[model samples]
Target: MPKRFQSVEARKLIQVSLKTNDLREARLLTGKMRADLHSEWEGRLNGSASPAAYPPDHLDMTLEATEAAYSRIRPKLENLAKQQELDNQQAYDAYLRKLRNTRDDFLRAKACKPLSVWSDLADRRISKNNWILPQGSEGYDTFVDMIAEAAIEAFNIEIARREGQFAAEPSSLVVKAGLKAKDDTAKDGETILDLFDRYAAQRLAEGRKREDGITQDRKVIDSFAKFVGPRKSIKGLTPADIRDWRDTLAALPPTYQKAKAYEGLSMRQAAAKAKAIGAKTISPVTVNKHLSTLSPFLGWCVTNAYADRNPCDGLFFGIVKGKNPRPPFSKGQLEKIFASSLFTGFLREGQEHKPGIQRADDWRYWIPIVCLFTGARVGEIAQLRIEDIQLDDGIPFLLIRHDESTGQRTKSGASRVCPIHSELKRIGFLSFVERQRSRANGKATCQLFPELEPNERGHIGAKPSRFWRDYLKRIGVKSGNDGLGAHSFRHTMADALRTAGYLDDEIEVALGHNQKTVTAGYGRVRQGTVKRINTMLEAITHSYISFSK
Candidate 1:
């Protein structure tokens, strides 16, 4: 016995038979027994096995806790309400309101005679393997309110039964507690996958989440379910289960999910294969992203009564400080990039670096320049329409927006206008727009860069991003996995804005980022705001690169 368990159990010695004659088999059985005993002893020490030592007010407001609390005192409350024999529906309604007030007062003051009754019930439940709410926690208050609400609902159902309004068996209060109703069960029962599907459907119906995001979330959830067990009930999930999954993901290759050799293999198998081949595992940031998806899903499960608590909470890999994964292009690298064959002279559109007389005025020639100036995403630049370019109050700016009908979408899901830089106009960008508009022949839906097309994932930047990578390598500006790409331009722009003494909010507005501060959301963007941003955009200047050819 270990020293930690000496005081845990009063017994000086505990014994269990291995029931094996073979030495190796006996050792394996003994190991399993030791693990089980350790788990049980730890649970006892943590108050999970005996509620007398349970900490107060720490349990989150989960459906299991709320339901347990409600079930404890519901029958007594119902009998009290029936004994009152309220004469009319108005009196019953008033009684319901009174119960609601008591609940609210208990939450605010954390004291009342009614709370004493609940506290007693909580003590009884502690011995019955149920969780107790810790006082002074938000979960404690929410738990009290939910139980009070359930009591009132029970009274209402009793009133209906007395008045002959309901004939069948009384419905469970779990539905009112935000759990799925008994009758709402799916065909084979609600698995983890079913809950995730419900979550995805609700988010998609609300239009707040994008399909691409949903797809990524689904992949993570699916992998987790498979890692644990495909048919495992969500209610059985524990923090240890989530921790094991996180550790496994950190060990596997970054491309294990999509790599051909790793396909159709279990997570552990793929991890072992990766270890054998000396393949690098996933970074902390990527592992954290997986946890981010699971955290919200588990939170939703708690709300919907699929789980007791979010097991994914606080389970994340620690990222190194001050080590940026993606770095901006250096000044020398930027100079080399703009002075390359694509910017100066190229053979033709496809063979830009081969050195020919053809001046490429297509997407190949314009998107990079536009991204460098606007700090806009490559996808945003690729999906622009001819009508997106307009003169507002005599100032030329590009309207970066989302239009579902036109297959154009912004990362933030909202729209912002970016003022065209003066250098672009000096280099005949407006003339290029005129030529595109003339080619459109009055078609409002015509794309600004008509040659660029969306890929299978509906992202127009896919091809352009690939081209930029190849171009950077061909121009000797970057090498494999050095993190320099089209997105580097946005980082460069942000650095330039910060260097010019612009505030983060102003730069965020210029780059179409969703503002984080409450004050930034107070005002609507009017013409004055646009002009102010335009003035801020004018501050970006590159002294090394000249507009003149």
Candidate 2:
């Protein structure tokens, strides 16, 4: 034979719990697992030995398990009846009542327990109420009742007896199911464990509030399951799989009205309650969200020592690079930029702003206002909490942050607090805060402009793009370029500041860009620079209300 290559030992070394009876089977599973990968096991042969290795409780039984249990206890019940025959019939009846009471309590306690946990369904029963007297003369007769207080405690001890064996071998769950039993309950599809792990870590790292978002993650996972091969693993997600998912999601455009989402989703709805934006094409922002969700899952495995490397590090979006990433806004398009930002939306029937240019509690105006003044991303502005704001000496400021795979890590791996204006503060911001406090306990979020709709529950809906587009058209503005939106706020605000004589360093601080340098070091807020940030804010918010000659 040619030179032999020493194969790496694929057998994983593990500690077997003394509680398990299938140590030999577990070892065999380890040997087979040694082949090409070291990962989570899927099918039952892996460590979780099948019932074939051991017999199950009620290995053969009828569907009416409760009735079957009652029937089995009937003989013992009759023997007790015979022993009590000579006693006062009423006393015998009283004794039976106590037994029945004890039995009812046992059923009540164990009903919630999984059937597998109880191999013998004899645990469930109940009896009718009754009264009885002792066998002695009526004057000396003792009262007997159904109060089985001490007996219930004893019955509980007996119920605990099965746990030692049943917990050791859970194989009874499938075996008892008979023909209905499955080899495994986990479906053949992609899962989101790693995805949530990574994104959760990013949120924590960025110091952002972390909430478990199972619904959204499930939407992506269940849809991906149908298209992926059987028994698919998330770790084995292929580029083609991502490409197909993206194309499919792209084909099914979201609708303009959020209400339309309630009708139903499709055979492969990857996004939950994802309403279509009125725009004809999917914007770069929207596409990036899909990537953000999928890529981080792969990243989670790498950071957690699960994988040697992140598979997402090299994966590119789309065949066309420019098609995926959005370019930063440029100069010379200030008015069009403002117009796009001011978009009011399509003139749909009975669906326009309610007799006012803006919704009463809308974030559309405030969000753009923040962008116009601070040049920060929409997401950064959107995630602001009232507590996160700092104000002192007639000034308001924001703690600019980027929630990454972990919530705690701010952008640039650092947080910078930026200032705000007296005028902007005057624009009902505090009144909005008071309103939030009243509804704090009952809303998606108290102390934020984007209050969660009670009906939608935990979902966060974006401000409508229609109102912005229409408002922009009303303001005589057009995008200088074909593809652009609220992001233009950064470019417009930057240019306006440059014209007002702020240097590039000042502009970078205003935008909270992730640049490292001596000036950026000073980007840290000084004790009294709220005045400076306020000055910067006053510089931008002056002309939003339109003027006429």
TM-score winner: 1
Candidate 2 TM-score versus the reference: 0.42
TM-score of each prediction: 0.63, 0.42
Q: Residue by residue across 46-75, what tens digits does model 1's lDDT show?
A: 866543444344222334344554444457
The stretch of ten residues in a row with the least summed lDDT in candidate 2 is 139-148
Q: How big is the positional error of residue 37 in model 2, measured in Å on the Cα after superposition?
A: 30
Go through the candidates in order and give each one's C-alpha lDDT. 0.74, 0.46
| Local lDDT at 150 for model 1 | 51
RMSD of each: 21.5, 22.6
